[model samples]
Target: MLDLLEADRAFVAENEAQILDLEAQITARQRWIDLLRDAQRAAKQRLSSYKYPVLTLPNEILGEIFMHFLPPYPDPPPLVGNLSPICLTHVCRRWRDVACKTPSLWRAIELHPSVHRLSNLGETLSLIAKWSARSGHSPLSIRMECRRQFDPISIFTSLIPHRARWEHLNLNFGSGSYIQTLDIDRPMPLLRSLTLTVWDAVGTPLPLLEVPLLRTVVINDQGSPSLVLPWSQLTSLTLRRTHPGACLSILREASQLLECRLHLWSQRTPLGGGAVVLPRLESLVFERDSEVCREFFESLVTPALRRLELPEAFLRPHDVETLKAYISKSGCTLQSLRVTALASLIQQILYRMAFRSIPTITFCE
Candidate 1:
C-alpha cells in the first residue's frame, strides 16, 4: 500500500504543472467568451435602437392598426396562421406587448371540443382560459360546438364566470354530450344574439334565457315550447326544423318581429281556426321544404309585409288561392314576390286570377 501511494504521489507531482497550465488556459478562454457575449448583446441592442418607421407610431395608433388587421365583427380571426393575432407578435417584441394588451383582438372564442380533445381536456381548458383572459372586459362572442364523443362540462364551467360578458352565444352540441341541463339562470345583460342547434337535447328544457337585450334569435331545433325567453322583444327570428303549430304559438307572442324566416316541414297543421297577427312584420321568407299549408297560411296577418319568399315545393291545390286570400285580407300592397322558379303554371294562374297589377314578379333561385 505504501509503495502504491508513493507511485501515485510521484505521478501527480509530475502532472501538477501541466494541470495548472490547462486550468489557466480554460479560465482565459471563458473570460474571452464572456466578453464576446457582452459585445454581441450590446451590438444587437444598438441595432434595435435604430428607428423603424412603424415602431415610431404611438401605442394607440398601433392598436388601431392592429384592429384593422382583424376581420369584421362576428367573423373571428384565426389563431395560429400568418394572418392571425399570433403572427402579429412574431414581428417584434413591441408588437407582441401591444397585442397582448389589446383585449378586443382576442374577444372572439370558438371551441370545438370534439375536434380538439384527443383525451386531453385539461390542455384544451388551459387554452380557453388563457384566450378568454386576453379579452379582458370586452364583450365576448363564444361558439361552443361538440359533434362527437366529448363531454364539455369542464369547458362550460370555465365560461360560467364570463356570462355577463357574453354578447353572442352559439352552442351546437351533439352525440354523447354531457350537457344535460344548461342552466342560464344568470342574467346576461349584454347578450343580444343567440343561436342554438342542439340535436339530441336533454329531455328537460334549457333554463329560461333571461337576457333583456336579446333582440335576434335563431334556433335550429324541432321545437322549444317550454323554452322561456322574452318573446315579445324579438325583432328578427329565423327558425329551422320547427313545427307549424309551434311556429304560430311563437309568432303569437312575437308581435314585434320585423323580419322572420321559417325553414322546416309541416308537423301538425293548425287546422283549428287560429290566427297570429304580426303587426310589425315586414319581411317574411318561408324557404326550403317549408309546408305553407292552408291553416298556417290563413293564420298570418302581416300588413307591413313587403318582401315574401315562398318555397319551391309550395304548390298545393288551393295554395295560390289561399295566398291571394291572405294578401287580400292583410291589405298589404305586394311589392316583390320571391320564389325558387317561376313556373308557367304559376304565371298562367297569376294571369287568370286577374291579380291586381301582376306585381313585378321576381324568381329567386
Candidate 2:
C-alpha cells in the first residue's frame, strides 16, 4: 500500500511540472505577439504620415506663388528644370500639381542654344510650341540667342510660322556662323519690339517689317543691307557699334524719333558732314571709344536735346572749353549732363563747366 501511494505522488509531481513548462511557453508566445502588434501599429502611423497632406490654398494664391517661379514676360529667363521641379515639386503633391497646371509658369521658352546642345534643339522648339499653344492666344515674347554653331535659317524658319503670335522679339547672334544664314524676309505682323545683335553680316534683305504698332527698335551692329528698319513708328532707337554713315541715314528717316543711344567703337567711321535736324528728339546718349567723340557729337543737330552723356577719356583744357562752349550755344534746354572720364580730367572739366555755370553736370570717374 505504501509503494502504491509513493508512485501516485511521483506521477502528480511530474504532471504539475509539465503543466508549468507549458504555461511559460504560452506566456513567451503572448509577449512576442504583443511586441509584433506594437511594431505593426508604429509602421502604420509612419505610412500615414508619408501620405500627401491636403493643401487648402485659393487658386489665386497658388497662381501668385507659381508666378514667382515664372520667367518675366517680354523676355523669358532661362529654365534649367531645376527650380520648378526639384525645388517646388519636392515639397508636396499639391505643389507639383499646381506647378504643372500653371500655363504662364511654363510659357517662357528660351532658345538660347549656348546653354543647351544641338540635340536639344528639337526639344527646345517643342517646348516653345507647347507653351505657345498653352498660352491660349496671348501674345508671346520670344528671345532667341545663338552664340555657338547652329542652323540660324532653320531656327528663323521654325519661328516664322508663329510670327503672328510674337509680340516682342529679341535676337542675339553674338558668335555663330549661322547668324548670317537667317531668313528675315518673313514678316512678323504682331511684333511690337525688336532687338537684334548681328555678329555676322549674312541674311537676305529683311522684308518690310511693317508692324504699324512697333514702338522700340534696337539695332546693335553696323547697318546691314539685309536690315531695313521700319522707322515710320519708331519712338526709341539705340545704335551700338554701328556704321556711322548708315546710322545717319537711319536717323534722317526716323524723323519722329524721341530717344537715341549711340555707342561708337574705335573702328567705326566718322559721320559725314551733314546737319541732322532732330526736331522732336529729347534725349541723346553718346558712349565713345576715344576722343573722336567730338566728331560724332558735331554730326548731330538736335535742337530740342536735353541730356548729354560724354565718354570716359582724358580731355585737354581746350577740349573741355570747347565742349562747354558748344553746350552753352546749342543745348539751351540742357537740364542734365553726365560726364565720365579719368579723375584729373574730370575735375578739370567740372571746374571749367562750373565756372561757366553750365546746367547741372554729374561726373563719373
Q: Mark the 10 consecutive residues where model 2 has the least summed lDDT.
A: 175-184
lDDT of 2 by residue, 1-365 (tens): 99999999999999999999999999999999999999999999998777332455665687677677655676575645564322565677777667666666655556766565435557656755655665566676777776445555566567666677677877776543344455454566777777877775654555545576777888776334547777757888888786566667778888787888877555345567686677788888776453344555656677687776776452344656666566555654777777766467657556655545546777666
Q: On residues 40-144, what C-alpha lDDT tens digit does candidate 1 reach at each position? A: 999999998888889799988998899899887666665445666777888889999999899988887777755443456776677678778888999998888
Give the poorly placed runs of model 2, Cα more than 4 Å off: 1-54, 83-93, 117-119, 147-150, 174-183, 266-270, 288-291, 312-317, 345-360
Best by TM-score: 1
lDDT of 1 at 294: 50
Clash count for candidate 1 is 0
Top candidate (lDDT): 1
Against the true structure, candidate 1 reaches a TM-score of 0.77
What is the TM-score of each predicted model, taking all chains together? 0.77, 0.73
How accurate locally is residue 101 in candidate 2, as Cα lDDT from 0 to 100? 64
